[model samples]
Target: MERFVLTDAQWARIEPHCLGKASDPGRSGRDNRLFLEAVLWIVRTGSPWRDLPSMFGNWSTAYRRFNDWRRADVFKRIFDAVSDEPDMEYAMVDATIVKVHRHGQGAKGGLKARP
Candidate 1:
């Protein structure tokens, strides 16, 4: 399975926003990072939870942990934290690379075109 690479800097920003961390960044932080990586792998591959690799631990357990995090809005807090700092690797995109189809650009379509 492909891995989700979070840099140490990125992880530092994200770690504080995550739930269930001990006062020390010990076992719990490592477990939380692994759990997060599992979720990210599922998302990156667009794979069903059942197909998660054993390296990430059990698929069902990861899914349940994902739900727990979601219910607590942990993801939102992480997004809010990370979004404030624009990391260059993912920060910029060229609008020229995006293509629009004619229909999407307000061309007449469907029944109107058929008539």
Candidate 2:
């Protein structure tokens, strides 16, 4: 009954790449889709791990699992699978989300210092 971020189809595509499947030999994840949703929740909200809601279970547990997956490169494979073809039809950079380097910002006499 949790609000989920991934559509059924998107979860379908990413599910196979997830670890701890029933078919795997080790301990199975309580719920792969749920775990994914929890991770996505962190990403979308930019919230600290300690602030992760109770619906997603323990924050520390999720953090540990996330790091485990990261070390195993599981996310990379999932990203590769799902992003096989990126849609560049409307790619644009927005200043609000973009960061300027200190040097680019005249920190140490940038353009103004130039001849």
Candidate 3:
């Protein structure tokens, strides 16, 4: 019901590739969608795993999944897939006016200014 919550249809499509086949027999709910959903929630919100909703699963489970995915380069794989799509392209360079930080303004009042 949350704004960023992934829909069942979306999960069905991504599950095959991301999670692969189901777990072995007698596997508890521990090896199911709850952990997967928790990981997705943490990533979508850009929040700490400890803050994951109880409905999704334990925070520890989510954190493990995130670290596992990172170590396995799963996120990079997903990005690569999306980037290969025909609709993705282009670059835009922008020069925006903004005040420079004091450290970035190098010797403006010194010999540098005279040149």
Candidate 4:
């Protein structure tokens, strides 16, 4: 399987936000980059944690770390850190008219039909 590789520029932006760095007080993570890539692989392929490749290390460990980061809101911080201003060039939602069902519209006689 082709692994995801972070470009030097991309890594530079993401490295500081990662937990378990050498400078951090607690035990350092084995390899933040590899862990991130493993996560990316799982997300990109939409595979279960058990299907993670052996090269990425134990799936359970990776999953645990992922949960830790998620609880800490690390992913949101990373996105905010690295993202640029939103591009609104293209319309995200169409202006096409949508039919919405009114409350009790389908009832037998109308709003008073219900007993």
Candidate 3, residues 8-83, lDDT tens digits: the string is 7555545544543455243234443555666666668998877888777678866776676678686676566445
lDDT of 1 at 90: 60
Question: Residue 23 of candidate 2: its Cα lDDT?
Answer: 91
Assess the local accuracy of residue 106 in candidate 3 as a C-alpha lDDT between 0 and 100: 79
Question: Model 2: what TM-score?
Answer: 0.79
Instruction: Provide the overall lDDT of each model, using Cα atoms, as 2-decimal numbers.
Output: 0.80, 0.88, 0.61, 0.85
> How do the predictions measure up, each by TM-score?
0.72, 0.79, 0.56, 0.72
Clashing pairs in 4: none
Give stretches of model 1 more than 4 Å off: 1-4, 23-30, 88-98, 105-115
lDDT of 4 by residue, 13-90 (tens): 999999999998977779999999999989899999999989999999999999989998989988987776556776
Worst 10 residues of 4 by lDDT: 95-104
Any idea how many clashes model 4 has? 0
**Candidate 4 global lDDT:** 0.85
lDDT of 2 at 17: 95
Candidate 3 residues lying further than 4 Å off, grouped into runs, are 1-4, 7-13, 23-37, 86-93, 97-109, 112-115
